[model samples]
Target: MAALMLQGTGSDVGKSVLVAGLCRAFANRGLSVRPFKPQNMSNNAAVTADGGEIGRAQATQAIACRVEPSVDMNPVLLKPQGDRTSQLIVRGRVRGTLAAARWREGRAGLLVDVLDSFERLSAGCDLVVVEGAGSPAEINLRDGDIANMGFARAADIPVILVGDIDRGGVIASLVGTRAVIDPADAAMIHGFLINKFRGDPALFDDGYRAIEARSGWRGYGVVPWLADAGRLPSEDAVILERSAMSTGRRVTIACPITPRIANFDDLDPLRLEPGVSLLMIPPGTAIPDVDMIILAGSKATIPDLAFVRAEGWDIDIRAHHRRGKPVLGLCGGYQMLGRSIADPHGIEGPAGTVEGLGLLDIDTILTATKTLERVEGIAGGARFAGYEMHMGETHGAGLAQPVGHRADGSPEGAISADGLVAGSYVHGLLALAEQRAVWLARIGVDAVGPDHGASIDAALDAIAATLERHLDLDAMLALAQRAGHAATNG
Candidate 1:
């Protein structure tokens, strides 16, 4: 197979976005390209066109490739539910939960599945662009690893190490990775690349040479921080660390950052609205006064419910609703807005029942079976599409006033009697232009930007154009082909 993997110096070093950009850059050149990550640890997921679920990053990368996303793109997805346990979803279906110890012990066996998926994808693609999870230098966790260098060594895939100069000491980062990993593992790396460069590349001329000199790996071009990066969906929650509350937009929307928040990218579409100011209400801070209060989804609904109560956000939500301000909930957040949540089977952790925020007349019962599918519906008289990935089934009088109807003509979601509060299991409710415009009109705002999907499409094209000018795509493709030939000869 013609392939190469991109591994980062550390987590959140922009590996996902870079791989996505490279995928688009190569696809633009008329090559059949695909993106793969053997294993991923994220709660931000997207439903594939094939009626399966995968990490949102891979789905976005698939978009860059102008193809429908498949579950094989991300074979193993670990969504953290608590400190030492996560819900494992393999090939788009729930495989069950694994404790920290069990996960470490069983990860090696999963390599078979990961490789199976990779090989299947590689069969038809001209170039399979692989992305590695975390850093290869974390030797402590290298044993039985399938995410980084371990997978590269297993698949005989060449690698290009990426470092974040924007984080400083990238020269040290690139060199130090070579210094830390086994020499055999280092041999798998064909070159190094510096990413998120801010100023002129000339400023890092010496630094670039030093990294190449120390590691004996050729330097790929330095990529400046793409200002349009915000237009893309984010894979890491760390970006929420410094999420600021803006002051100038005509309408303000706030969502409290729950500890185990999932699919937070639902807020990305809000960024496209020039008249909207979006904010991530940080912990220890009370919910700010805003036009709308969104209860973001979480991987652990019960625990995050307790978390919301502990932070007194439940009180803030009630007060906001009393003031006649709109409150919207998606998935787990929808569960939280109900009168109660029952988890008798311990499906998510120590089985128990918890009281919800009681803003809406509804009850949710957690179950072992999870719903994962792409769906389209008409809500508030506007047609929109979204996905469902939840383990709870809600039923109550609220169902009578369904917010919408699914493609199958089944009732979905709910709008309160007064219509000031709404909740749903949908994740991408406002991605469509008309849907977003309707949402804004509900808040009495008369502004709506371009179609959310179009914005993302244009941004992908921009990123491809950017990489075409900066990165040496021709050389990278040549390197991948050369490696394949060398392996065949050997």
Candidate 2:
């Protein structure tokens, strides 16, 4: 199989988005394409069709390729849980937790599993586009690295280094990478590309050439800043820091950005609504008076609940609830809205009980077993489809008034006596137009937004078109073909 890998000069350098675009661009040519990430560290995850979880970006890429997401797409997922520890997932299922001390050796041992997934995925695809995590320039981490040059060498795939020109120092970043990496590793990078270039591409002609001359690698193309990318789901939490509140919308919805936030993309659909203004309230800032407050998913419910109280967001939420404004919680947020949370197995931390925000008449207990599945159900008299990926269980009088019903006729989530507070384990409910419309009506905005799934498809097409225009597709195809031949022959 023909394969090309995209490695970035640093994190958030647009490697994921570029790979997704290339996947779509190649798929448009009627070629079978697949996306592969040997390892990824993210909290925003998607439940795959195989009943497992992977980073959300891979799921988006699968959609771009017009395929269902599989655990093979992202074989190794590291979900950070604070205190220098991460929940390690191998081939979709949780293996255990990896601490900072064991990070190197722990990941090194997973190379076999990663390659197995790669080989399996390659068997069914004509071309595979691989995305590297972080940079190869960190020589200290090069010892047991499986996410960059190590994987590239193991798979014998050609690489194209990407630099974010929008962040400046593009010339230095690309050249600097070549300057620091091992000679054998450097040889794998056949070319480089400038990403997120603002303004006219012509203005950076000299800088682009300078990188080529200094790094001794050919230039692929200079990609302009993509406006459509904002319409897609983001994998990194760093974006939350840079997120700004949208203005001029009729209804304001506030979401407090908690530490270890996971699957916060639940708010993405609301952002599309013309009448809804979604504001991500960062720490040290007070939660503003908004029509609704949504407590998003969290990786560590107990710790994040502490963070919420420490940041005085708990006070803000209470005041908002007293004002009769709606408050919704999803997954961990749902657990946090209960009366108390018990952790007997130290699943998240030291195995203790903690008081919740008490917005609803419910109590929760963290469990080792995790639920991962796609589901469809009825909520607010509208049919909705989404997935459930969460741990623990909640029960109380609130269960009598569920926010919705699962297709199996079981209660799905909790609703307050006053009907102003609700919590659900299901994510992506608002992505459906009917469900979004129902939520919008609660805030007195009767407008229905565009179909979110269709909008995402259109955004993917727009990005593919942009890449087709700005990137050298023929050259990339040639590189991938050459690498494929070499891998097969060896």
Q: Which numbered prediction scores highest in lDDT against the true structure?
A: 2
Candidate 2 has its poorest 10 consecutive residues by lDDT at 446-455
lDDT of each: 0.89, 0.92
377-471 in candidate 1: lDDT tens per residue?
Answer: 89878998989989888999988988899989999888888887889888888898888888889787865677777888888889888888888
The Cα error of candidate 1 at residue 294, in Å, is 0.5
Candidate 2 global lDDT: 0.92
lDDT of 2 at 232: 91
Error of 2 at 184 (Å): 0.2
Best by TM-score: 2
Residue pair clashes in candidate 1: none
Error of 1 at 93 (Å): 1.8
Error of 1 at 466 (Å): 1.1
